[model samples]
Target: MKPKASPKTDQSTVRQRIVDMAARLFHQQGYNQTGINQLIEEAGVAKASLYQHFKTKDDVLQAYLAQVSQDWFRQVERAIAPLDTPKEKVLALFDLLKSFLESVDFRGCNFQNALVELPPAELNTRQLIRGHKTKMSQVITDLLADADPDLAAQISLLFEGALITSQLYHSVEPVNAARRIVERLL
Candidate 1:
């Protein structure tokens, strides 16, 4: 018989399962509303097991944000990688948002959602959220090098506004509007 798998492998699977379950719950519900007890219950892990992996509830939330950020970055980069031009890449960003809105799991932007209840002094999570936005804005900045210096900032606002507006109206109209404006700016 083949050698048995190490216990570490199984433990990692449990950790990943917990993170995955927490991610879904946190998105479907609100971060402020998610509790550690609920996460343990839904994740099907004992309190001791959760503590062994995550020091605290905040740690679990941070871990969820970290994982989602990685996935989101990869998704956007992949979606724009084969585009014909930077303009196409920029527009493709809108397309990405469109798909996100159309998804059955559509929740407001995770980074933005995480910051909702945070006090002004919450720098770690704020920095994490800012980093995601900055990278996204850099894509716009790279694509619009010849435009106004503030164009990226403007587009960034429009980009964020689209997410909030879409959430407000429960429609993708705002993303389309932002795309039109971006097209004009480009």
Candidate 2:
């Protein structure tokens, strides 16, 4: 005999399914290009179920952005966890970016991509993107607390640049080059 799943658990699972499918679709295709009907179809959930979880398409997008922000930070923290020094951790960030870019086939930053697709009126979505970036900058600042204050800012810029360049060229060479520059800065 199998155990029965609780109502809450079932609902949560369905919600997660929608969000996961939304992330994949939104990332693979532009945000504006992905329709609610497509998300419902791909997620294998009924239209009612999708609406039950997310009131609007923007709500689903907000949820996706929130999830990605948490996931991205966790990945960054894990990647830098083993390093002993601030500089080492900072350099490791670039290495992590290289691996991440390769793993995603140079898809580039999700927030950056979303920003381009979003209209200027999307204040909430824009705020979420800005918050993610601000948190990332804070992480760099924390890592370089004892170094020249400007280094963190500079590294952050390089990191973003590397991501864009890597995506543009469909290669990780830009990430490697960024790592070298970071090494020199450190």
**If scored against the real structure, what TM-score would every candidate get?**
0.91, 0.97
lDDT per residue as tens, model 1, 12-82: 97889889988888888877788888999999988888999988777777788889888887988899899
TM-score of 2: 0.97
Best by lDDT: 2
Give the best candidate by TM-score.
2
Q: In model 1, which regions exceed 4 Å deviation?
A: 1-3, 104-106
User: How many Å off is the CA of 109 in candidate 2?
Assistant: 1.1
Candidate 2: residue 157 Cα off by (Å)? 0.3
Whole-model Cα lDDT of every candidate shown, in order = 0.84, 0.92
Q: How many residue pairs clash in each candidate?
A: 0, 0
Model 2: per-residue lDDT, tens digit, 1-186?
999999999999999999999999998897999999999999999999999999999899989999999999999999999899998898988888898888888888888989999888989999999999999889999999998889999999998899999999999898888889889888
Question: Cα deviation in Å at residue 115, candidate 1?
Answer: 0.7
